[model samples]
Target: MGTGWKLYYTNDEYIDERSGRCPSTDEFMYYKRLDLCFNLNSPMTINFPVIKTFCSHMSAELIRIDSSDKQQFIEFITANETIERICIQGTDKIFPPNWTFDDGTLMTFFNEDEASAEPDGGKGNIEMYTGYKWHDISDVTLHPCLPICEII
Candidate 1:
């Protein structure tokens, strides 16, 4: 493999001492590629503990994802049933509590009330929203999956 791509396999490049965030494009690309090596049933975080830890910190907030890397992530999670829910979290004060898709799509999850809503009458059903929704809040196990897919 080329040295230019070495950063992906090497964990040394993702360390962020100050914020503890793995906000690197190279690191994202590495994970995007790593998806090719493992099944969705496998735990992706185990392969990159730094990023896994960083993302776990923000599972509740809507995420701000890199536009360049979002598609691959969406495709991976949607395709792999083993891998459940992905969310974006950030510490920046300016960031919103909720997140929008890089392409400007709105993604959300349904609360118990919304999940049980009936068709047509259940306007709150999150799955009925224009974009994607998680199986439920508890299923949101994957965090920042897209951040690791950013193209360097």
Candidate 2:
């Protein structure tokens, strides 16, 4: 439990996040020591709220990479795949910004996009792109991103 990645308990088995082993599930695949189950449901989003609603309807939540291990796991999964970028849970919409996980865990993990200084202005949401580095863009931005979600 000291790994710090969020976990889930059920009639399912929990696998170590680093092992790259995931418990059996539906279309959503699990990853990391968090046993975080991810679903690439393909829901389009013009903003984070849209992604939030889509996840809520699925009884899941937006993807939140809270650790380097989780981030690397994501990169591993995306390697050789055709995904250009995926929207993740992170936003500076608030005065202080909240990159919190759905479980209300504050995000302490960071991987800059390096193309531009993130949060370029005052507000924006986060995205995982090239080399799986994190990028921040305006909330109003519209791009055909691979819709990704996490099931608790």
Reference-based TM-score of each model = 0.25, 0.70
lDDT (10s digit) by residue, model 2, range 1-152 = 57878896754333322223322443666544567777665536457777788777766777777788878777776666675777888766543466555555677888886676653435557787766777776665657666677766
Residue 74 of model 2, lDDT score: 70
Report the Cα lDDT for candidate 1. 0.31
What's the C-alpha lDDT at position 49 in model 2?
77
Instruction: Give the CA lDDT, 0 to 100, for residue 30 in model 1.
Output: 25
- By lDDT, the best candidate is 2
- What is the Å distance of residue 150 in model 2 from its true position? 1.0
* Per-prediction CA RMSD (Å): 11.7, 9.7
**Candidate 2 least-lDDT 10 residues:** 14-23
Candidate 2, overall lDDT? 0.66
Worst 10 residues of 1 by lDDT: 121-130
Put down candidate 1 lDDT per residue, 1-152, tens digits, no spaces.
66666444546422322122324322222242322211122234322234334434532122333333444455545563443333332221222333334333453422223454312221121121113332222213333233222211
